[model samples]
Target: MSGRIDLGLLVAALTAALALSPAAAAPQAGVMDARAQIAAAPSATITNGLITATVLLPEGDKAFYRGTRFDRSGVVSALAYKDRQFYGPWFDRISGEVRDFAYDGDDIVAGPNTAMVGPADEFDFDTPPGWAEAAPGGVFVKIGVGVLRRPDDAKYSPFRTYDLVEPGRRTVKIGKDAVTFTHTLAEPTTGYGYVYAKTLRLPKGQPRLLIAHSLRNTGTKPIVTTVYNHNFLTFGGAALGEGLSITTPFQITSGRPPSAEAAAIRGRSIAYLKTLRDKDRVSSSIEGFGTTAADNSATVHDDGLRAGVTFHGDHPLSKMQLWSIRSVVAVEPFITLVVPPGQEAHWTYAYDYAAA
Candidate 1:
């Protein structure tokens, strides 16, 4: 027998040795470990190899829009990405109190002296015929969507509650790359008979999410209202104060500018003046938007975390507002819908995240 093995035999032996080596087994072992860890994690949470998130179901009794009696039933909680949170603490504010308004039979007598709600069309249709002129005092009833109006404009209607029926939720995975959460709500009564649906998706291996919405008027009356997402952001569990800023692509004309001690606008961005103390707040409405949704987009950045988030929509933004207090920063983007009976309208929004 030859002292050395033949070349073909030697090659075969080397190949067999490599196949059994630790390096060759490491990849599969690592994968199995990750899978085991994920399987052990809590249910109500999602992870896509890159980011992890928790799903927040409606609290049933918590009111989304302060003062409104309607319960919140939808995807209404904080979104965590890149080790940072992107929502305000739930139940952080007091319930919005109903304002006094006098009613004389079917007509309002007095009380809501100023326009405290808006988007113009909702103020016209959602509110009673003569809310502003109603007698100086009367009973209070929650009736329309709550929105802040310009202080100088008494032409709009006062804040009222919109009865948001509890939303039905369905969650599913799309292939191996994404997960989708759908929330559907329909007006239970003949009043407002508007059917609303929203689908939120998180794609695997990406730093972005998508939200699609549809509204249909199922009643005999036309449904004219404005819908907006109040993105209340709390970065790294920090309050809204110094080191936080917001930027837009166009010039901003606020309905209410920030106070001198809170923040200021620099070029196309709003920079915090200082770390806000408790009760300190900054709020404003951003004007200067075109008819297209592409023109409406904004970014909220936190210098302390070196992280930021961008929000954009697929439909025209009828209005935009910014509000922040010591605890939360909210960027509200409004869309106007004029769906006739049996008609429907659709829109979508995208959120992108980045970190340095």
Candidate 2:
């Protein structure tokens, strides 16, 4: 008899068992009488049974500033499910040194900053002349929508920036099952005319949070861009060490395999190779995805806390990346879309938390 267990086969067997289990036979019931409120500070909070989420109002707290004086809105700081918080300060804080730059004959300078999440369209910045010579203190601001040259173009690059400022929000109740926080950005800034809206919802009884977003190109130009959710997840203050596993529906292919000393991949999952010490890091850009949104789901299980979170995208994934350090773990999912003039693009994401 063999004493060693084959992890890959074990996972396969367990997956088969789950599919046949009675618990998977029907949909679970959801919570009831869920409600969302806006505090005096203008922050928004949604509470339903054991699930609660606080979305920091851009006007109230300066914690998640994007390091830019212009377009100082449209960022949400913290989201929590019980004791587990999904977002936090960036791993690297910006240096305090301030430098000056000239944009459209106006002087621009770096502003007070902190880490941000879910900012979009990262690859559309114009490297200003002498930008490399300036002091490195400004935080990277990479959220917007626009059209640009495709990857294969070699001669010209159309790197445009947009200012989708802080949105206006309202709360709405839908039937008896869920409450939604709807945020809208209607006015165009920085030459982009578009209608952008994001809704955050908490359903009754279900241990999940839903985020739905829509973008309409009201301008005369077509909007060709990619958007991603930069999920900065901190598992209830649990350290990023051993007993952490990331599971995907499909095989993973990265530029380099997880370090043998840090993590291992078995079947369709990746688990920590060993407990990571302080300052230890693991980062990678992963591929190997199918053609459907169901193929783009992943789960992060924290064995130490006996809890986990599953992230799902309702749109086909264009790319995926992962980054982790001592403090936080980020799983980024990218989606590509094109909105012709007078057309719109839409997508949804859901986060479900569980505990053993």
Candidate 3:
């Protein structure tokens, strides 16, 4: 492959599952009653009692996700551990049809704007600095989203939602288990800016959840980019093809392999042979990992709720891949963000949970 892998790891190889299948335990059985039935936005909830999480605060039209394609600063959601529930809400609403997701009738919409859900993190995801030579009233730069407006180019679709012009300086604290998000921008007429920060901890007793990041290169060009963590692993809402699976130490070879009836990479694991119906998918391009960071940690199992979670990274992996559709299963991992202007770059990810 050429990309993917990065979800969060370390729970002694957690594996002891089952329990949580009410559409994935209905947002941990009442996360403010499913955020008041999805859409009141402004969220924050962290529990150290045993891994309980939720973070989504950008509130504009109740920003659950306003689509610009990820990195809406720490926008996590329903991530239970013991009671079993890992990541939730995998598209079923929010559409405009710009580049990615779309369904309409039965729900599931994520296009033109509304690119959402957990582990959401992206930057310069395929052309974001002027989106294909900006023209049409020019302007571009999407480091945690801000300063966009390249309306009409026909190409440059991170699920199109452009036309913000400026959406920087955002902040959110909320602690008790941890939650911090920051964003800043300058954009000297397209020099690219940043200050980005993201945090989401829960380490009290330790079921695990730690995702820290930093980026500082404050404007004036020189922020070569690449930031990944789309690991939408949805054990909650579990149902993405036969009991789910994905375990990797490094041996996934994929020259675009995906769809051997669904999934099956073998060697280091990537099973799941059937269950993703209707618009089904299982993308690939996850080559053999090497070059450090413990060959890149990864683990995800479900054997029908016999839960598992492990995805760690302290930097090194520059790309890895795996995508699963039918309610999520992303193994995305890519990290490389050279800073220059002012310089500063950091990466961290950890997640470990299990169930019995």
Candidate 4:
């Protein structure tokens, strides 16, 4: 017990915690009834045609797990974690308990542990009610350029400058019968924050998608930022070595070799996409994106297939971390955004998906 959190130990701790904690409310059960939804569901049951194999994040207002049939059967699909508890109280106030979300059978895969799934923060663009997980202000927004170095001083303070410019939630139309739920900000979390997500209803629907925007302040006073998304994808019943295909046109900026644990979690993640060029597939016609005041943009044509995602943020290199459990992939996007107490920054990324 070195005190450092390891996956196995963390899993056990989470299990025990959930096993002992009595549910504040009864588990909701129904096919399409919103009122019959719940935060935690037993992994022993089934949803639609999939089986609920594993339960992740059993300790908070949210608990995420997988459906039957997909690869990595019974895995975590969504949850939240923070480096500190100072903000826990605030988060507990505005955020709602997690709900059951089914996935669309076409195009992409999904998994447990996807951040910001289900509904938007009840407070919408309002500052968090309190610091529950990552202090009050530390909301996964990493710092530094190229190298990620969280600010030393104001690490997890409250988000004093954070404000909600936009108050209503809107669904973005994506292909036929496909839409994403999002909340736009006038005074966004960083510079301009757009969270694109959805709540899955059954087997023929799509899981939620979240794309957070933040900015970084360079020493030259040049405002640099990046756009990142913590997309949790699952391919239920699919194996890791099946040569999962990803098509994209953006440049592969880096290659993050998988950790030994990552290799164990899922084999494909062992060869993650550090940079765009490293991808096994690509589009010759598509190039880069146009420049905007906040960040750059790139276009990725899937050729009617499920391709990789790309973004332009304030940071130099757009980074993505691949986490997996056999059939699912969490392509977490991130950039250097300086929210160092007094400094201000922001960035954005536009994302889309297609079925291969």
- Candidate 3 lDDT, tens digit per residue, 190-309? 677778878788887899999888888877778888888887777777677887778888777878878888778899888988888667788887878888887667887877779888
Q: What TM-score would candidate 2 get against the native?
A: 0.65
**Looking at model 1, which ten-residue stretch has the lowest summed lDDT?**
17-26
lDDT of 1 by residue, 51-105 (tens): 5444332222221222232212233244566667665331221222314222233
Candidate 2 global CA lDDT score: 0.50
lDDT minimum window of 10 residues, candidate 2: 16-25
* Cα-based lDDT for every prediction: 0.49, 0.50, 0.70, 0.26
TM-score of predicted structure 1 = 0.63
Ranking by TM-score: 2, 1, 3, 4
Off by over 4 Å in 2: 1-42, 60-63, 68-83, 90-94, 97-114, 117-191
What candidate 3 gets wrong by more than 4 Å, as runs, is: 1-69, 72-78, 92-103, 119-137, 145-149, 152-159, 162-192, 195-217, 220-356
Cα RMSD (angstroms) for every candidate in the order listed: 17.9, 16.3, 20.7, 17.2
TM-score of 3: 0.32
Task: List candidate 1 segments past 4 Å from native.
Answer: 1-43, 59-73, 88-191
- Collision count for each candidate, in order: 10, 7, 23, 56
Stretches off by above 4 angstroms in model 4 are 1-228, 235-241, 246-315, 339-344
Q: TM-score each candidate.
A: 0.63, 0.65, 0.32, 0.31
Q: After superposition, how far is residue 131 of candidate 1 from its true place, in Å?
A: 10
Per-residue alpha-carbon lDDT of candidate 4 for residues 1-356, written as tens digits (9 for 90 to 100): 01111233223213111121222211212232221122333222112222111122221123221111111111233222121100001011111122212233321212221122211111111122122233433332212101111233353322222221123222222221112223222222333332323322222232212233322222322233333443344332223322333322243322443443223222211232222211112111111222332323332222222333333344443334444433334444444443443354443333332333
